[model samples]
Target: MSNNIKNIVYRTLSKAWATLLEINYDYRFKDGTWKRISRESYDRGHGTGILLYNVDKGTIILTKQFRMPIYHTNKDEAMSIEVCAGAIDDNDLPESTIIREVEEEVGYLVKDVKKVMETYMSPGALTEKMYLYVAPYSEEMKVNEGGGLASEHEEIEVMEIPFSKALEMMVSGEILDAKTVILLQYAQINDLIKNRE
Candidate 1:
């Protein structure tokens, strides 16, 4: 509630790529005590991710790209396999953003996308809520050679792998991205793959 917070102050630390804020606020405890706290939150805005599956073929589309953060952390391997995703810019809806992302990142124009779930990716420090989706696709959906937007410095490699193999990759630690894993597991749990046959 608004009454629980007081003396809130926000300082911008960076605004180049995304906005980062250092926030200080006073909170009222359950015992009626006030405590001041300081925290930093990175606000890059909310985004969406979609797992493209071909039930008939038992395959899913994934994208491979170089992730700078992962490169810095791992030192050797930097390319990450993940579902097609992007941030919702301006006032665009999450579903619209994901549909555009799917086209741009994987070259697929999909209809009948199902909203699976929405979750906060990193609640501890970052403010990002990701909308997850799944869509059934066929070869006719391919409209262009999707490699992402070069203007945004995106060099994505599109990959179509068997659903079973993707699950194995998750167990083998090859698919490390949380959203990708969650969507993959969702497909399995919902019997989306099995029903395709």
Candidate 2:
């Protein structure tokens, strides 16, 4: 693999909330030839997402918010329904980041969370690894009214829906986010909801 890589050059395209770079590289083909390629990649760092479930209620917590990128591409479908998620800051681990995001986005203070999976959300054009988690929540965990942080322009609307209904939405395309869909499917396939009941 090392011998196949000839050269790699990274050029910065933008450095806003996320860093965008134009990558130029040379690869040695199997037929003993070299090919140059250029690709653009967005680096937003790693992130964490959590699916909060209430076993007694047979429901899961979700959040709705406007995504500008989605809005620009599909005006009709601007708002996204997603599980509680946030980018992991430099100082915090994935576990702590998701815990804090859960409380801030859904008003649930979860102490025990299980890390289920790790995935590269969009490896083709973005450099972001998402740590997926699941946590149990009860009524007592709701200590505050969570709508996300106003300073970050997060206007999230918390929603609690039955696990079955969330599955239906996933099939019907109402729930479009990739990470959210993965967690919901994981919950169903693993009988997480049924076991709770």
Candidate 3:
């Protein structure tokens, strides 16, 4: 409800996997002039992402899954490597959502997680605020062979790679997911895991 904005109108364009809305609004510029603008926003809601690292083992857990949008753009590299993440439910907080996703997606029952940052995956067109976290993981913490949920039609490949290798992948453009790259870089900056042998 800023004075700079007025005469807002919203229309739903589609509602399936995510809600698409058409918006029209009047904006008052710094010159004291007003202009009417129309735009569309895709609302898939907020989500959380966590990067699990093993300090002693010098390794990290990542997931590989097929992204339809990425598939549309890069057919050869449709399988995207990313941190464990999931959409936040209306009833759930960011921390809880990530914890549950870690367990469901990576098969790790991690209770203590340190939130690193919150980011918008794509601010321009999609309204998805990503809560990023880092957590310590060990072999004992793993509860199952997580490949994602069948009900959600998620087919994920769990990866346990060395920290240095993860960094190399990031630099080589193998880790294309922005959230995953950010969390990996956070781990590197914070020395969460051993960078070299």
Candidate 4:
């Protein structure tokens, strides 16, 4: 607790699919005055997302799936094109979670993935720190059809698109997922693919 903030309190609002809590706190102003405030925080735990690329093929693996939250905002276009990702779940490390997710979500059993960065997808209300990564992939690395798991009701469409096209999609507003966009930009800025023309 910082000196600027004090008298913290938490109350559970919901404990379904994810946990939601209402937090009340008192803040001290620079002028020596204190004020109380209330805010709702949604704790869904942390997750990971990875950008699987193939320099030899000049392409990248992405996933297209229906997002209910997106549907809530824009019903006309609820399908989102994004990097393969999932909740960290019981995995002890973010790296392990992403590795397993890559195989289960995209059918690629990638062994080496370089962590690029981590970000809070939505810090204002959601407590989800997304571990972003980039990994090299090839046909030999694929083990299955990688459309996500049926148990989770995930109907993910695997897309192996040219790197340039992925960039174009980012510009065309087709790839609106923040983690996907950030990873794509990271690849571009870092020249992760050399054969991309």
Candidate 5:
């Protein structure tokens, strides 16, 4: 939490976890007049996270997992070609949540989690914050036989694909995760990714 965030006026407009609406009242100093300003009511939502890594001899490790919401929209049984990501659950620390999610979705421990980008997943009406994390592959990283816990009812598949192929997938529009695109773009700028040949 930064100093700027410590004093933002928060007023609740609606109450719902999925669609929490609120307004931030701001007091601005303008030409000897203290003005009371307000922005439109927006929803507050849990944040998203991501993890990226390179491994397996020029391969970028990825996950092929099932997403019920995505499957519901596309009318597909399983949603594949997703990056390792998850939503921050109920006050869960961003680092810890992403670490757990990365392990569950891809079966590996990522090192050097770096905060890449933070933006709204959907800002039109639904307020979802997305945090992008980048990591380097370490030799000690191992993939154990683990899908998300059955009680949590998660079924994930882990895979490693050549970096070039991963870029192709992105180009062909196979990788559709919102956070994935943002992270991939950041990786490209930061030279975490190899140029596509």
Candidate 6:
């Protein structure tokens, strides 16, 4: 390794991510002493999404929403079943994002969203990462639709699929989305949503 040829990791002085057809295009800027190099790197963005699992009833709350990106390729296959998740809004905490999104999308307040795993949502062209979690809840917890803003173009529909049925969906290709499949199987394998009180 040459001394001058520093393999220094480019630090983002500032950046902005625009949602392009349900994907994030993050533009970041790195500052050097001599000049600024706008390095284009994939972040695999760190965001939070939760799988609401009910142990006593063995059920998991989910959402049925339309995804534009998939619809573009599939044409007719736009709507999807997914766990509640959203990007970590600029400088916003993952916890905050989950709490807010839960209320807005599926109407749940996930208190202890146990960290499940972190992985890239897509690795080929775009740089995006996801922090998957399990949000445990019961009758005592608050769950209600927060009604998305019409001005922002959000039309989210909520669904409560049984744990077994959710698993079936994963196997039968009904719940084909990556995050939804991952969370469902992960819960089943870990016994996170077993029928227990």
C-alpha displacement of 73 in model 6, angstroms? 1.1
- Mind giving the per-residue lDDT tens digits that candidate 4 earns over 1-197? 39899889999999999999999999998899999999999998999999999998899999999999889989867999999998988546999999999999999999999999989988999998998989999999989999999999999999999999999999999889999999999999999876466
Across 89-188, the per-residue lDDT of candidate 3 in tens digits comes to 9889999998889888989999999988888878889999998999999999989998889999999999999999999999999988999999998988
List, residue by residue over 28-145, the lDDT tens digit for candidate 1: 9899999999999999999999999988889999999999999999956689999999999989999889999999999999877899999999998889999999999889999998
List runs of model 6 lying over 4 Å from the truth. Answer: 1-45, 195-197
| Ten-residue region with minimum lDDT total, candidate 2 | 188-197
lDDT of 5 by residue, 69-169 (tens): 77777855356776677778888877788888877766677655888778877676566677778786644676775466677777767666766777778
User: For each candidate, what TM-score against the reference?
Assistant: 0.95, 0.97, 0.97, 0.96, 0.71, 0.75
TM-score of predicted structure 5: 0.71
Which regions in candidate 2 have their CA more than 4 angstroms from the true location?
195-197
lDDT of 6 by residue, 76-109 (tens): 6688888888878678877778878887777666
- What is the TM-score (0 to 1) of candidate 4? 0.96
Q: What CA RMSD would candidate 6 show? A: 7.3
Q: Which stretches of candidate 3 lie over 4 Å from their true place?
A: none
Whole-model lDDT, candidate 5? 0.67
lDDT of 1: 0.93
In order, the Cα lDDT scores of the candidates are 0.93, 0.93, 0.92, 0.92, 0.67, 0.72
lDDT accuracy of residue 120 in candidate 2: 98
Residue 190, candidate 3: Cα error in Å is 1.4
Error of 1 at 134 (Å): 0.4
